[model samples]
Target: MPADLSHIRQVMEEADCLYSEAEVEAAIAQVGERITAEMAESNPVVFCVLNGGLIFAGKLLTHLRFPLEASYLHATRYRNETRGGDLFWKAKPEISFIDRDVLIIDDILDEGHTLSAIMDFCRHAGARSVRTAVLIDKAHDRKASPDLKADFVGMSCIDRFIFGYGMDYKGYWRNAPGIYAVKGL
Candidate 1:
């Protein structure tokens, strides 16, 4: 199936820009600095949660300034729709993370179901430690776990349907210039 290009264009035209590209960049830099300070010497295995985490991880990795292994895992709940479902693993970590400090970078920490599951998987797989970094933390009470939180968060957003900087809506607009909330969503 092909995307309706006109609808996609209209969505961007009407969406509210929650954060500009510059703002997003600054936040990423800040998070990167914090991560570097804490994990620079840990030699962690960094996992980019695809496809949402793609843009964020790419930008964040440049600031680490440390020796670490970078890889990706494809696990998604929203296979491109607005709603999420059960976890679907398109790919899992192929690199050995046993006895290694692991960092999972993702686009947003919404309900945290996916992130929590990934963290647990790493722990069970013999990772010495597991941490998470998210570009956006949606402020809400309905989480997979009440205590679930990202170790590093680039920004906080109200509960809204958002897309851009790797986030998508109906499998489109991951390339939007900044963070945007769908009109009336």
Candidate 2:
């Protein structure tokens, strides 16, 4: 089902702003620093997990002063639903991962299922190394994969239904300038 535009707009108006644009940029800069320091020399193939990761990857890529090729893969556990379910692979990168250092960028780390599967996929594709990055790390103890974690994390937040900054509420609000948690969530 599609979200009501009016409700989305109303939620945006009332939702709590978690991080401002400047702060998000600063966090991305810090993440970029770590990526540059560790993976720049490896010429990694950066994979932006599609839809949600687009904005974060686009912004973060600008600060990465390295020679890395950018591509994207489409995978989703939450396809327009508030709660996550099964993983679906919509698309994969055209470039081969063989012997390549793969960097996976995502919008958020909620349960770690998608990221973990992506990491496994990259490894199965023969990637030399696989590292994950996310704009937000949802602070929850009940992760789907407990041992997995992002190599680079921009921000951490209490578990809540969140939107904005490449994350959407019913497929809207992704273009909001800052991170926001849905009101009453």
Candidate 3:
């Protein structure tokens, strides 16, 4: 069962931020350092997955000082499920990407289906290389299916559904200060 407000309040009482405010700032700084060191000279194509990845992608861009193109694709598989569901896609961005390096920024990588599909689509759309960047890597029950995984990972997660740092629970807690594990979970 989902945790009640009382339980949530209890957890909040002793709640510890997995990434404190300063930690988040420091991490963002590190992200800039890593991205610049890894892909500065590649002239990559940056793709930010819509809605959830918005916050993380924005912050990441601050550190990515390179010759790159930015685009986005809208794909989601969630309506009301906690765990990942199926797959969905929208119209791809209309930016020329033939033989160009592409980087995808996403909020989370759970089952990897949606992201894997995105990478495949980008390749088909004529991207030379498609790398991925995600704020959180939810590597739970992952099965090798397609030739798509984030070449760049910001954080690692086990399997539990979480919210915060741009992640949302039923579209509610995305703005929460600290990332939160579901209470009693």
- Which is the leading candidate under lDDT? 1
Which ranges of candidate 2 are over 4 A from the true structure?
77-87
Steric clash count of candidate 2: 0
lDDT of 2 by residue, 4-88 (tens): 8898899999999999989989999999999899987998999999889999999999988889999999987778887777777
Best by TM-score: 1
Q: For each candidate, C-alpha RMSD in Å?
A: 1.8, 1.9, 3.7
lDDT of each: 0.94, 0.90, 0.73
| lDDT preference between candidates 1 and 3, better one | 1
Better of 2 and 3 by lDDT: 2
Clashes found in each candidate (C-alpha, N, C closer than 3 A) = 0, 0, 0
1-185 in candidate 1: lDDT tens per residue?
A: 89899999999999999999999999999999999999989999999999899999999999898999999999877677778787778998999999999999999999988898889889999999999999999999998989999999999999999999999998999998899999999
User: Pairs clashing in candidate 1?
Assistant: none
Q: What tens digits encode model 3's per-residue C-alpha lDDT throughout 1-185?
A: 56476654555555445665566656666766888898899888788898778878888888887777877778866655765566566556668778988888888887677788778788998989888888777765564464446677777765676777788765556766756677545
Candidate 1 regions with alpha-carbon error over 4 angstroms: 77-87
TM-score of model 3 vs. true structure = 0.81
